[model samples]
Target: MAEFSDYIVYVDESGDHSLTSIDPDFPVFSLSFCIVKKDDYTRAVVPSVQALKFKYWGHDAVVLHEHEIRKSKGDFTWLLTDRARRKEFYEDLNQIMVDAPITIIASVIDKLKLTARYPRPWNPYELALHFCMERLLMFLTSMGQQGKRVHVVFECRGKVEDAELELTFRRIVGGANQWGWVSRDFSVMEFEPKFAKKSVNSTGLQLADLTARPIAIKTLRPEQPNRAYDVILTKLGQIKEFP
Candidate 1:
C-alpha cells in the first residue's frame, strides 16, 4: 500500500484532432498530464515559473504558449532572429523543467492505425484521455489509495468541447463507458474524479503545454533526438499508445 498525496493533474494536448489533415510526420495526437501536489504548485512551481517568465519577458502578462515558443512566433518572435538568446532561453527553460516537482502521464494516438481499425473513429482527444484515465486509476491503486481523491485541470478551449469532455469523463469514471465496466480489477478510481478549469495564471497547464509537443515529437520519431522528453523521463508515470 502506498501513501497518496493531494494531487491535481493539468492536461494539455498537442497535434491536430482532424483526421483528414493528419500530418505524416506527426500523425499522433498527444495528451500530457502535468501533475503535482496542490500546494507544491502554488508554493514552489508557480513562483519559480513566474520568475522565469519575468527574466525573459519582464512582465507577468506575457505567457508561454508552446506553438509560439516552438515556432518562435507571438511574444517569442525575437527568438527567430536571435539564435543566442533562443539557445539560452531554451536551456534555462529545460533546467526549470528538470527542477520542478511534477510527473507526466502521456497518451499517444496512432491515427494511421486508428483509421484502419474503425469505420469511423472516436475523437482522438477523447481516446487519449480515456487511456490516461485508465493509467490514473492504476496509479492510484498502486499507491494503496483506492479511495483517495484527485482533481484534473483542463485548459479551456470553448464551451461545446468542454461540455462534451466533462460528460465523457463522468461516464468513464462512473463505469458508464467502456473503460469502466470492463475492467473489474481497476473498477473505479481511488476517488470520484473532480475537475476545474485552468486559471490564466496556471503554471501547471503551461508546463503541460511544454510537455505535449516534445512527447508528440518523440512518439512520432523514437529514433530522433529529444532532450526535452529526456528531462521528464524520470518523472513520467505511464505512457499509453492507442490505435
Candidate 2:
C-alpha cells in the first residue's frame, strides 16, 4: 500500500464540452482543481461550509451548487423572497471562500478558437484534464509530496463518461501527454482518482463546483464586474487560458 499525501484534489467543470451547438452567451469550458491539505480541509474548510449551511438551511445536507444558487431553485428558494437576505448569503459564502486554504489550478478552453484552429478538435474536457494533471504533478512535486499517493475526487457523471474519464486519467498518468515526461520518473507521485456523488456533499467538491463557473465567466468576459470571481481570484495558485 502506498503512503498517502497530505493533500487531496477535488475537480469540477463549468459549461458543456460539446461543440455541436454552443450557447451564444458562454462558449468556453472551464475545469477547476481545488487542492487542499487534508488537515486544513477537515479542520477549517468543512466547518466553515457546514456553518453556513446550518445558518441558512438548519442542516448540512444542502449542496452549494452554483447554478441552483444562482437560479434560486429548490433549497435556495428563500433567496427569491428576500433580497437583503440574498445579499447577505452571498457575502457569507464569499467570506468562506476567501478564508479557506485552497490552492486552485484551472484551465479555461475557448471552444470557438479551438474548432477554428483544428478541423478536428480534441474534447475540451480531456484537453483541460491533461493540462490540469501536468500542473497538479508540478504542484505536488514542489510541495515535496513525491512518491506519495494523492487522491483526486471527481463528481460522478454516469457510467460511460466516468469510464472514459478514468481511462484518460490513467493514460495521462502513464505519461501519454504533451510533455512526454513519465509520471513515475518525473513526478514521482501516484494519482488515485475516485468518482463521488454530489449527494455525498463533500466540502472540497462543493468548493470546486463554486469555483469553475466564476473562472469561466472571468475568462470569457474579463471586463465584466464579477464579485464572485473577485473573491475566487485570491485563492487561485495558477490558471491557464487555452487558445
Candidate 3:
C-alpha cells in the first residue's frame, strides 16, 4: 500500500536544448521544479492566480504563460496597450509568486561550455532533468517523504519530446541514475510523471514556467537585475548549474 505525498511538483523549462545555433542572448537551458504542498496549492496558489486573471480578463480562461505575458502576445495582447494596467498586473503577479508557499529546485546547463568541453555531450534537457530529479528525490527524502508517491507535472512539449522526457524521468526514478543503489526501506521517493498540455491552464505548471527563465537568466548574467528572479529567490530550495 503506497501512500501519496502531500506535495506535488510542477516542471517547466527555459531555452531550447539544442546545442547547435545557440541563442547568444539566452544560451543556457534550465529546468525548474516547483514543489508545493497540496494544502498550500489548493488554499493559496490556485485562488491567487485565478483572482489575478479574473481581475484583468473578467474571466479565468487566460493562461498565465511567461512568454506570452512578457511579449504581450496571444491572450496578453491587451497588456501592450495599457502600461498602467500592465505594471499593476505585474506587481500583483510578482507578489503572488513571492507569497506562494512553494519550493523551487532548478537546474541550469551552460550549453556553450558543455559543447566546448565534450566531444559528444548528452542532450541538455536530459542532463538538466537528471540533475533536477536527483535533487527532487533528495528534497523529498529530507522532508521525510521517502517511499511516498509524489506526482510531478510537466507541460507537454510535442509528442516525441514528451515521450523522450517521460522515458528519461522513469529511468532516473527507477534508480537507473548515477547513484546505482536502492534502499530496502525504499528511502528513494517515488515520482509519477503527469503530462498536461500547455492549454490546460495548470497553476503549478504556470508557476514553474514563470520561474525557469529567471533562474536561467540569473545564471547567465548574475549581475543583471532580475526582479522576477529576486522574487523567485525567496522560494528557491536548491539550484544546480552544470557545464
Candidate 4:
C-alpha cells in the first residue's frame, strides 16, 4: 500500500470579505477547496490546467483570474460557450477527472447576517477561513476510514497568531486519531504565500466566493435552508453555503 506521503492535497480560498465596502449593494464572502493526489499532480492536473488555458486563451500560461473561470466570462465563457470546443474541453476535463483523485469543498457566507451574529467588527475573511479549515479537516477524517492517511497542504493566511490555527488543527487531528478516523501519525503542512501561488490552483476557493454572492444578495429575506448550504453553518452562524 502507498503511504499518505505518496499523495499531496493543496487547498486555497477566493473572494474578499469586504465586498460591501467596495460595493455595499453587492457583498459576497466565499471559501473553496481543491484536492489532488500526488501521482496525478504532474501527470494530469498540471497538464490539463495548462491545456485549459491554451484552449481558452490560445496560449499556454498560468491563469489565476477567479472571475474568468467562476463567471465563465471573457475567453473562458467563449471556450465553454463554443459547442465543439466545449465538448473537447469537457472531454479533456473528464479524462483528467477520471485519472486524478480529487475532491472539492466550499462554504459561502452571508456577510450581513455574520455581522449581526458576531457584531465584533472582526476580520470576516479570517473568520470564514477558520471555518473552511475546520470543515476540511473533518472531511478528511471521515474519508480516511479506508486505512489511508491524508496529507494536507493549505495556503496560510498571513496573521500574527496563526500559530493558534496550527495548534487547533493538531487538537482536532488528535481527536480524529482517537476515533480511528486517521492514524496516530498523520501530518499537515502549510505553505507560505509565495510557494502557494506557484502550487496548484484552487477552484474550491472560487466556488466558496461564488456561493457567498447569492446569500449576500438575499440578505433581506434569509432562509434556514440557505444556512444548510455550508458544513460549518451551525458553528460559525449562518455564514456558509456548501456544495
- Model 4 worst lDDT window (10 residues): 189-198
Give the whole-model CA lDDT for all candidates, comma-separated: 0.79, 0.91, 0.88, 0.47
lDDT of 1 by residue, 1-243 (tens): 323457778888998777888888788899998878777888888888888888988987776788888788888999989899889999988888998889789998989889989888888887787778777777666655565566787887778877887888777676655433364344444333434454465777889989998888888889999999899787799888886
RMSD of 4: 8.3
Task: Please provide, for model 4 over 1-243, each residue's C-alpha lDDT reduced to its tens digit, 9 standing for 90 to 100.
Answer: 434434444544444567346344444455545454566666766666676667656765444443564466754776556789776765664454444445554555556655666646445555555555555555555655234555555454655434654554555444432222334333342212121332344532222333333344334245534422232222232235521
User: Which residue runs of candidate 4 sit more than 4 Å off their true CA positions?
Assistant: 1-7, 19-22, 54-59, 62-64, 69-100, 143-194, 198-243
- Residue-level lDDT tens digits of model 3 in 1-243: 569998999999999999988998888999999999999999999999999999999999888999989899998998999999889999999999989999999999999999998898888988888778777777788888977889999998889988988998887766565433342222366678999997788999999999999999999999999999999999989999987
Candidate order (lDDT)? 2, 3, 1, 4
Instruction: Pick out the ten consecutive residues of candidate 3 with the lowest summed lDDT.
Output: 178-187
Q: What is the lDDT of residue 116 in candidate 2?
A: 88
Over 4 Å off in model 3, which ranges?
178-187
List the candidate 1 regions with Cα displacement exceeding 4 Å: 1-5, 144-148, 179-181, 184-199
- Model 2 alpha-carbon drift over 4 Å, by segment: 178-187
Alpha carbon lDDT at 206, candidate 1: 85
As a TM-score, model 4 comes out at: 0.52
TM-score of 1: 0.86
How many clashing residue pairs appear in each of the predictions shown? 1, 0, 0, 8
